[model samples]
Structures are given as structure tokens and as C-alpha cells.
Target: MALSFLSHCLIGLCALSLFAWAEKECRYLPGDSGWPSIDDWSGLNDTVQGRLIATIPQASVCNSLPYGNYNSTACAELRASWTEAETYVTRPAEMMNPYYQNQSCDPFVTEKPCELGNYAVYSVNVTGQEDVLAAIRFAKEKNVRLVIKSTGHDYNGKSTGKGALSLWMHSLKTLQIIQAYESDTYSGPAVKIGPGIIAGEAYEALANVGYRIVGGECASVALAGGYTSGGGHSMLNTAYGMAADGALEWEIVTAQGEYLVATPQENADLYWALSGGGGGTYGVVLSMTTKIHPDGFISSGALQFTLAGAPNESSFWEAVRLFFEQMPSLVSDRNSLQLEIENNTFDVFGITLPDQNISAVQPLVAPYLEELTRLNISYTFTTNFSATYLDYFASIMGPLPYGPYPPTEIWNNRLVPRSVVLNSTANNLLIDAFKLAVADGTFLVGCNGINVADNEQRKHPDNAVFPAWRDAIASCSLTAFWDFDAALEVNLAVKETLVSVYTPAIEAATPGSGVYLNEIDPWYEGDWKQEMYGVNYHRLLDIKHKYDPDSLFYGHFAVGSDEFTVDGSGRLCKI
Candidate 1:
């Protein structure tokens, strides 16, 4: 019994049966309609071969009962590692949704029911296309809200919904490598991956042979959902392109319960929307086939320095300012970098110089290093060369910082454009804003040098990725965290402050720049369509409305999401 709460579902089945007798169909409790009954749910479970799993409240916590096979000691360890990405993916309904297992439920005071907040009522642990089709059809017909989850590493709360039936794709881990994939738009080697495949799994599988693909930096990020669907950025983004740019086709089940294959030639509209349009809104993805590259060499390293003891912060700012000035030349030459600023310490990693070694990069970075030396800022710049991408990611990037369940953080990001980075006035404004954010308790600042999407290949697909991405020199983000026991108001205030201060800062620095949708605040009070998708928003809306007229699938920041609202009690209701 591998920590499964399903086997113990019998405890609630009897009560659900009583509720089934009182109701004949599934409906929203607030709509004066009956919710799904046990009988109705049983039918779905039968069709899916017992794959339906009940949402187990508090199952991931150590204090919860019905611990399955785990002992007290193991449960404690499990709780400690709840922040790890793998932990949430295994559970039925525990990802990205900050309110999960936090809201206080009425009547029940036990370890279990005391904290099942805003989680889906049930989840179909889908393993095949048929299961996805069945789940979609069931939700549409029964008037049940639907959500999709793949590894549950979402930052925008798109993977979970309240009182909904979710399709968990994490178990559908299938990876097939096509030695040569031929298509009208692209003809080359490719990999047809299940929507559930995470970055680490994909990389390990690809490295087993000799290939690489554009993907998320975090090992737990699922490639098919928020990653690729939101225009996946990678260390190789400057050299290759976004993950969406590499997408060739997708197998999805639509709101109408139709299983369709979307590619450049067929279902072209859906393909465009799925490529860079937000996930869990247009349709339910079953599998995605994307382009793959042959094994290649990359120069990678980590660099860091401290400015704490500096006579003035201006010198430190100048050192960072000089680095930004040199970004265009480095990025244009197929080089990418990620610089993390925490207080006075700067930690840089994921330094990718394609087809080059450590020796070759020394000259390019000499000017920046000289500037740092002039400021008397001691820096540690180490370099290494790897023959394969996997080796470089493993050795240079090392293990990613995965979190336990019930996360205590939220993120707000902006794609800083080249214009702002290069302009002296805008650059100073950007630095000042960052300083304000840091002073306000924003602990980490992540800046990644990325290539603009002005190349010929990016335009051909006509993707829904934000147009600003094509003009961006780097993606910048701020992370805000709070104590686990902090009040909801405190968390909300923190997020509000982050958005209020940073959004303006970023906007002033780079006017009209858009944010990376995947990492944006869920309660974003701005023009998301214009901010996230830019000119492509209208077309995305047309496709979304045409495909999901009933608003059957709605993710935060998705097209037409403004028509609905999440109330104080966490109920999603139409405005």
C-alpha cells in the first residue's frame, strides 16, 4: 500500500451513496442543482477501470490519519519532503493551488477534513487518450468543472480548481524517440512524449541515446502543460528557441469530447493555441511530439560575487549594469546566462555557450570581469566544458531546489526587453525598482539572458506566445515568500505589494513589455490578454471561444477568464 488514500475511500463511499440517493445528477452546490452522486461517479470509475481516485484531504501531511502503509517515522519524513515536486505529483490533488490543505472545513475537526481547501472533488488518474476523452465528456455532460494536472508544478494555479473533476496526467509517462520525424514544416528526429513527462525524465531519456530538446530548467516541470504551452524557455533558448517553437504536433481531447490531432496541417488553429496559448484552457493534452537535437557540446559554469562591503552600492550596480550592456552580443552568439541576485550576493549559473569550451568564453566575458575588478568586487567565476547537454545541466546546474507541499511562496515575472536594458535612463529606473522590491522583502531576483524570437523559424508557426518575448533580452522575476502559518490576508498583501511595486518598475524600465504567463500572479489586476499574449490575444480568444464556448475549461490568464471570478469562499462563479 504505497501511501494510497483510494483504498480507504470506503470510509466516505457510504456517505456519498446517501448523497447520491438525494441527487440524481452532478451540479454546482451554489446553482440550486444536485452535485454528482456516488452512482454517477461509479459509472465514470468503471469506464476508466478503477482509475478514478477520490480527493484525499490532508493525505500528504504527516499528522493526517489513514497513512496507508507509512509509519509515523516515515510520515514525518514525507512531510519534510512535501515541498519536493515528486511528492505533489504522486498525490491526486496537490499542486500549484496554494489553498490546498489549508482552508478550514466546517464540522469536521479530525486531522483529515480539517484542511481540504479548494481542491478538486475527484481526479481521474488518466493513462490513455480514452481516459482523457472519457473525463472530458463526463465533465461537459454532467456540468462539472474540469481541470488538468501534470506534475503539479504550476506557478499560476492553473493545475487545480475548486469543486472540479481533474485529469491527472502525471502517470502517463511514455517517451518514444523517432529516429527521423518527417513533416511538412519540419523533417528531423523527434520525440513523442506523454503529456506527463517531466523535465528530468525527458532529459534522462533523451540523454540515454544522444539527443536534447528545449525544456524548463526545473527538473519537475512537465513539458507538455504549462511549460511548452506557455512558451517554454530554456538555457538553450538563445541558441535554439522556446520549447513551443520546437513543438510539431499535439494529441488532445477538446471540450466537445472530440479526440483530435493538432499540427500545422490539421486543426491548425488549435495547434497554434496549444503551442503558446495558456494550458488547461484550450483543451486537454494527451501527448506532444517535439523537435529534438543531436548531442552537442556546451560550455557551462557558475559565477558569484558579493557587494556587501562595497563603499557604495553604485559600484555594485555598475558592475551588474555593465553585464546587461554586453547581453545582446553574447545572446546573439548563441550564449545564455542566468544571474541570481540575493541581497549583496550574486550567483550566476547555466552559462551556456554552444559549441564552445571554457577557454573560448573567457575573452567574451573579459570586459565584464574587468569592470568587477575595477570596482574591487571579489568574484568567483568557475567554468567547465561538457560534451553533452545532460552532463552540463547535471554538473553545472546541479540539483534544482524543489519544495515541499503547501508551498510558502509566489512569483511575479517580467520579460525585460533589450531597449530597456540598453537605455541608460531605463536601465537606472529598472535598477531602482529592483532595489525597492528587494527592500520590500523580495528575496531573490532571477535574470536570464534569452534570445528574441525574431528568427525565421519562430514566425512561421504564428504561435500565441507573447510578442514581447521576441523583443526581450532577458526574463526577470521576483519571488515572495511567507510563513506557512501566516494568515491569508498576509499572503494576499505580500502578493499585492509585489505586483504593485515590481509591475510599475518593470513597466517604467521597459514600457509595454509583457510577463511570462506561467509565473505571473493569479490575481493579476492588469490587462492580461494584452500583457501576456499581446496582439495574438484576439486570435487566441476566437479559438478559445470557438472551441470552448461553454467555458468548460478555464485556467487563470486564459482567454475570456475575465468573465468569471473566484469569490471570497473560493467558489468560481460567472460574473
Candidate 2:
């Protein structure tokens, strides 16, 4: 009886120890105590299949000892190439967040020395679910903040955290095509992609098998990560739907270290939450299964007219105004339209009539052509009908935006409903706002909506993609940029200009509508709960608490993010 009592007492003590460990907040860096020792981290690295890498700032590649295998000449080339998209995307620590690098060091400034700031001290170069699970378990048990990253393509600063452990999911590149995916909710063709698989790669692979999937416009974007979870928009969206709408299932590692498959019938709540709840807030997803469509032809093209040569600047604005009025009909006809205006240049490009040929597309575009001629604006309009989606992407879509340089920029978005676009006064207000943004050198872009019609044939779970998207006919965004050498105050002024110029205009134009959460202004000050998620914020919050009660995962502007604030020093502090 005495021996048995002693054993029970030891078990109780171990449980108490675990509880206490979970309760205490772990501090590192500036903190004098509570940081994990080298041995503790080494043990964790071992458990994760030896994938942990202490983050080294990319800027250090040139200045570090022995040049890390590069000579002075090679270092110079690397320094110049550091500004390219691949340079940052390939590294675990380097990313799009200017604040992560403290906005002090950049490859643009040849004279200034670079140093790391606010970047995670260590990153797990995750290749599988085991690494993610172990990292989640360690972060929760030690009460250390955790950041999840895949390809470092996140526009918002969600993938970076100060003095934290990061799970770099970029190395987890795996893809498989299921000729026939059978499920109670969905029974069709599907593609299972690891967290690291990019949108372009997925498109190429799917096209090879006579299938195509809805994914992001950017080729470099990670489809299985934030893109799908945040309601991915695509050129194919007009004919199909948002990327999240095609999602059939996800395999994720929860905060409790449980690796579970979430589907419509199993872990239904998690499935719903993750579908479009905004990534980095739910569990770390290992793989995502997305519905694929049969490969088909897409009638796509671009038309550009110089605003400078127009009779007056108002003439260009008039063209844009007329375009907005026709958006609903164009969207209904399965046309994905895009408008980009900067300075004296105006460009319109997109795929129209996904199932129709170029001959059928000519009549649809004839109206816009007539309008341009009547306005005395000579425009260059070129249309091509590709045999497959891959041809369309490679020839038309991929080359549209050009290279991925100019890594830093200020951007914001608004979803304009069809009703508002049809309203004359509201439409003019949006036009005036666009003009103002252009005057401030902000690049303007707009896309016609994809979820114009619901397909009753395809069954899926409900997600948190702003319900405004359902009624909206178009999504518009404004972007302002500066070179790496631009002053901090200049960037701040650009953000303020965007806020002062576009925010109220969008509000006046579409009173009840909201912005796309994924592309929303990082500095957006409105009621995010209502704007980003519409009526779904409350349910998403509940799901967040259910899975991450301690708030281990946090994406910027995500549900339950109000509990924490990023301080001036770039530290994420509990409210």
C-alpha cells in the first residue's frame, strides 16, 4: 500500500509540473531569466528530425565570416540579387515585412551595414508534420510565441515574430493528384498539396493531367497555406470560385500537438474555420486537398491606353466609369476583368468567357471598343484564345504583373457590390478616389468577382471568407511604393495618403461592404470584425479559442488578434 501511494504521488507531482510549465510565460533575448537553455533547444531540434536552423539575416551573407562559401565578388552579386523576390522567399527568416528587418538595413543601401532585428531567433526548416507538431507543442508548453511560414510570401507581417520559434514550412513540398477523390461532401477529382507547393507549380502539374485548379494570381504564392485560408482570388475565379471554395479537406497540427485530418464530416468545425478563417490563427496545416476542374480553353488578353493622350484626364476617368457600370454584366458573362492605372498609363487585362472562343469574345468586347473610339482614345487591344489553362497562365497571366521586385509597398483593398457599382453617385465617388490615389502615385487595380453564381452541384463546408464577397461584383485595391532608400516618414505619409484618400471613398461608395481580409490595408482602422469576416467573426473567435486557447498562432488582423498588440519596438505584447 505504501509503494502504491508513493507512485501515485509522483504522478500527481509530474502533472502539477506540466500545469505550471504551461502557465508561465517564457521570455528570451532581453529577459534576464526564463529563456530556454541550449540543451532544451537541442533536445527539441533532435525531436524535430534535426531541422532547426538559427536564423541569419540575409544581409549578413556579405559581411559574415568566410563569406559562408562566397568570395567578395560573389558577395557583391548576392547583395544586388537580395532585393529579388526569390532571395527573400527562399530563406526562412528573410521576408516581406520591413518591420522584421527593422527598416534599417537593405540591399539598396550600399553604404549602410545591415543587422537583424525582430526576426525569430531560430526557425525549424519543416519538411513534415512531425516538425510542425513538435514546434507547436514546445511553443505552447513553454508559453513562447510561435510564427508559421510557408514560402515567406505573406503580405501581412504574420510570418515574423521577435525572439520566437518559427516553423518554416517551405521545405514541405509534396504534391499528389487524385484521379477520383471520393467523400461524403465532395466526390470528384482533387489535388493534395503540401504547405510549400506554390500556385504556379500547382497549375502546371494540374494542367499536365488535363485538370486545373483555382489558385492565386501570383505564381509564387503558397496555395496550401494562407492563400486558400484567406479566400484566394484567381484569374479562373470568374468561371469557378475562390480557392477556399474548392478546398475539400486539410491535415493540420493543432496547438495540442494532435495531427488530425479535418473534413466536412470529421472535425467539421475546424474544417469550416480553416477554410477561410484567415491562416496563422488556426492550426499549422500540413497538406490541403483542393477540388480540380477539367482543363479547358480561356479567352484572355490585355488592352492599354495612355491616359496622357486622352482628350483630358477626365476622359480616362470616364472610360473607367463606363467600365464599372458594365462590371455586373461582364462578371455574369464569366469575365475576370483587371484594371491597372499608374501615372499617365492605363491597362486592362483579363480572361473573358472561359468556355468561349476568341471569336465569341470579340462581340463581348466590341462595346468597350466602341466607347474608346467615341472618346477619341486609340487603344491597343490584343486577345488570344489558348488551347489550355497552362498556356493562358504562361502567356497571359504570369507575364502580366512582371517581375516580383519592389518588395516593399503600401496596399489596401475594398469589395464593391454590384448594387453600388450600378449607383451613379457612388460610382463617381470611387472614380474620384482612384484619381486622387493616382495623383499620389498609388498604383490602382480592380478585379471582377468570381463567386457571382453558386454551384449547387458542388457541395462544401462554409468558411469565414467575408460574406460581402458573395454580393460583390468587383474587388479593388490601391498600392503606393518607395525604393528601399526612401525615408520612414515618406512611407508613413504614403500609408496616410492611402487611408485619407481611398478609405472614405470606398465607405461612401459601398456603405455595407467590406475589404478582402487577405489584401486589406495593414493599417486599416475600421471595425475589422464586421468588415473582414462580416457575420462570421464571432463563430471564428469561438473556434479560435477552442483550438488555441492560449493564442499560440496569430496572424495580423486575424480573429482573436485583439488580445495582442505589436508595440513600437516591434514586440508582440499581450493586452
Candidate 3:
């Protein structure tokens, strides 16, 4: 009876896979193309499902609407040019890629400013690998722009675009517990991740096998594309490395529309690039294969803090800094800890220590406790509790509410060096700055630090679409939640340290530095060639020109942007 039931389920899955593999039938024969059989000059006018799918602009109706970025006349002109073969149609690829301009709200404090472009770009719901291959081929043949989006977590708007047709890969998430065809005792079962996989889901999937992939520490961040593409950071990073380091293989849809599998043995250059080259510098990533670690070590809990009611603020900052300094020795490679500061009035810090046992954490944090007590500061730190990935994730983050939950609105981020907090004077200034923000009743803070050593342990993946970081230890982001009116001013004030330190480091470095592609500011523009990509830029360009001669893919950090690069005067230009 059991065998029969299992067989029945297998048959059902086969049928489902078949249905998903079918493609939209083409009604017209594209000239010199293998799609349809017929060939004739007049056939150009013939209507076909292929043409309908390929020719429609990702934002066909955007030009006719009242968008925040354009005046009525300019919008109309932009629309008119798309329907014709004028200068606008000939314009450099990058200009028309965004679903909505990412930087549109940079100078504004709107509630939606935390979000980037909408689902206004491509409207694709692809199911199989063939669909991705076809999308790539179709864009190449039709002279339409192309970009891929999975979770749309990208901050600089690297996912969807207007001139660009969307190749949505989020449907590819197929979580599985499969031991590779050949494996030894050490190999263990691997988690099969799809392009749309998020850290939250991957954790759940791996939990089934008593294991978890060291990916996506951010609850809402996607693991396969967005986070991995930008060298994803996580609570486990202090012990492991960045997310890219764990990637074993990837099924990528290239510029030439070929669906290729990249691994250490095949397409090695692409393998290197995607690990951390930053997004939009290479082909659209389909899915990744990553490392699976033994699960059940996660220690999750939240602690709250308040300065207004507390007797001392300086003591609080010192204790916090001191705790981080001691954090390295207390935890090993298997543990994870995330600290979230809610506000000066009250702060909730969540710690997920995946490497150490629960009993060990209390002892490790004891020194800070004593110091806090000595300074006459009142505080509460939870006893570490062992929990399953699913339970921990659910309890810690809660459910996603309607219209995108506003509380965990830490939508985007950039990696700041620990030096900024530990070594640089920035740490000293940061305490006062955070204190001031809280004193003024304007700041609610959540800080997440991922130990990224495991991510950079091996040679970094230097291709595909991510930036490379050198032996990076952690990625910290500060999110300030505020009322609609106060959001802009508050964020600007919080960003002062970033503007003064991290931003200048990037531009001032003989070569600039790079933040995660998923966390860049829309208003942030730069050559970024050396800083973001290091040595991978030139190689990525060569691949871009080879497979995308007409340069059809141009959304969310389009490649070959030579024509639209920012000039010496910060003027937007066409090369």
C-alpha cells in the first residue's frame, strides 16, 4: 500500500513537470529564425504569439501614464519614440531599464521611498529552463531590452526595467534534499536551490535534513539571485564567509540565450564573477548550488534596550562595543548571532548563534553584563535557546503583513567595515550620533552583522553579476524606521557617517570601494568599475559584447553602459 501511494505521487509530479515545460506556440515565422517554418518579406506583418510575447515593451503603458519622474510632454515623447525607430529607440540601453527610476525618491522622504521601482517592467511567469532560454533568444532577435528579477530586493533597481523585458526567475525555486549522485560521509545531502530561493526558505528546506545552507541571514532577502549576486552577508558570516563562497554550481542563462551550467570545471570565469562581481555586470543568473551545513546549532532570541529611561548612554555604547570585541573568541564557525537595536528608548536585538552551544553564549556575554551592571545600566539579555530553523525564523521575523510589512523595512543596505565601528574614529562618532538620534526621539535601529570569513575562504567567484570583497568579516546595515514625513530627514541624518566615511572610501580609493548591489542608493552613481568589480569588469565587458552585440539586456545595472556613464561633471551622457 505504501509503495503504491508513493508511485502515484511520482506519476503526479511527472505530469506537473511536463505541463510546466510547454512553451507558448508561435503563430508567425520569424525571418531567418528556426521558430516558425515560413519565410517571406510580407510575413513581417504577420501576427504571431511569438511577436506578441517578444515585441511588447516591458512597460507598454508606462509612457501613457502620469509617472512621478516625467512631465506629460516628455512621457509622451518617450512613448512615441518607442513605437518608432528614432533617437530614443537608438538611445543607450541603460536609460530605459528601470521599472520605475530607482533614484526618483532619493531626495524625498515618502513612505514608499524605501522601495524601488514597481512591478511595472516585465510581466513574465516562466516555469521551466526552456522558458528562460527562449526569453533570452527572443530578446536578442527582437532588439528588446532584457533584465531578470527574482525577489526584486535590489536597491539600485537591478532587477526590472522599462526598455527591458523581464525574465522573472522567481518561479524556479525547487527546494529539495538530494544527496549528490556521488558522495562520501563528509559530502552529506545537498539542498537543491532554485533562482527564487530566499534565505528564509532555504533555511526551512535544509532544516528537513537536519542541516541548513549558510545563506540569507536577512529574513526577506532572496538567497539564489539578489543576495548571492551581491556577495550575501549573514549572521553566520563571522564563522563562514559570504554567500557566494558556498555556491558549488549555477545554471545561468547567458547573453547569447544559451542555458549553460557553470561550475569549477565549466565556464569558470562566470563562476568567479557571480560569486561577488556586483549585479548587472554579466548574464542573468538562473539558480545556484550551495554548501549545506549541519543544522540545529542556531540560538535565536531578542533583547530590548532603552536609553531615555537608562541612567547612562556612554556606558551603553562602551558595553556594546566591548561585547563585539569579545564576540570572535566566544563563537566558532558553526554559530550565528544577529543584533537588532530597536531604538534608544527601547531596542530589540536578535541573536542567532549557530556555531556555539546555548550554555556557552551566556558565559561569553557575561563580561558585558558585569560592565553594564558596574555602570549602573539596566538591561536584559536572554538565555540562548536552541531552536529549529523554521520555528526560529517564524518567531523572530513574524509573518509578512499586507502591502509589505513596514516594521522590518530594512529594505536595502551597504557593507561597512568593522573598522568603521571598531578601529576608525567612526565608532566614537557613531555612538554620539546614534545617541543623538535617539535623544531627539527620531531613531529606531536594527543592526545585523554577518561574519563573512567562510564566504571568502576559497577563491571568490569573480563573474556573473556581483562585486568582490576581500576577506570581508561582516556586513552591517543601519535601518531607521520613521513616520512618512520624518523618513527622509531621519535617514539623511543617519546616513551622515556613511556619506563621510564609506562613500568617500569608495570614490577616494585609488579605486573606489563597493557596497552590495542589492543595497546601493538610487542617487549613488559612479564609474565603480575598479571599486565594485576589481579585475572582473573588463572580462565581463568582453562577454557582454560577444553575446549581446546590440546590447539588449539593460535593466538594473545594465552592462556595456559605456554610453550612459556619468561624466566628469556628474552629467548623464551617451558615449
Query: Where does candidate 3 have its weakest 10-residue lDDT segment?
Result: 23-32
Sorted by lDDT, highest first, which candidate order results?
A: 1, 2, 3
Cα-based lDDT at residue 172, candidate 1? 81
Global Cα RMSD, each model: 8.8, 6.3, 16.2
lDDT of 3 by residue, 1-575 (tens): 99999999999999876644321111112221333322421232132223222323222223322233424454355444432212211211212222133333222222232222332223344566666666666555644445666655555555544334566665677776666622321254556677766666676667766786666544545677757766776656555556777677777777776777877667776666666655554676666777776666556545555565467766666655555554444334445456644445434355666645676667656776676677677777776465665556556554421112232132233444444545535555544444443454433434555444323343433344333344333334445442333444554544554445434443332122345555544545454555455566678777666655655555335446654543332222234
Which parts of model 1 have CA positions greater than 4 angstroms off? 1-27, 30-33, 58-75, 97-113, 400-408, 455-460, 485-487
| Per-model TM against the reference | 0.89, 0.90, 0.68
Error of 2 at 369 (Å): 1.7
Instruction: State model 3's lDDT.
Output: 0.50
Q: Report the C-alpha lDDT of model 2 over 56-128, residue by residue, as the tens digit.
A: 7766544533224324675677667655556766788777755345554455443555545667778999988
Better of 2 and 3 by TM-score: 2
Residues 1-575, model 1: lDDT tens digits: 64467656765797788676534332354233556678989999999999999876544344343434324675556546545566676677776445344444311123443344667779999988889888888886776778898877766667776678889997888899999899888889999998778787788789889898887777778898878999988898877788888899999888887889999899999999999988888888888999998878888766777777455677777777777777787677678898877667667876778778678777777777887888888788887889888877776444632322234357778888888878887887877777667763455788889885666544425677777888899999887664445566777777787777666666677788888988787766677888898888889889998888878877777787877777666666665
What's the lDDT of the predicted structure labeled candidate 1?
0.76
Clashes of each: 7, 0, 42
Error of 2 at 93 (Å): 1.6
Which stretches of candidate 2 lie above 4 Å from their native place? 1-27, 62-75, 109-113, 399-406, 446-461
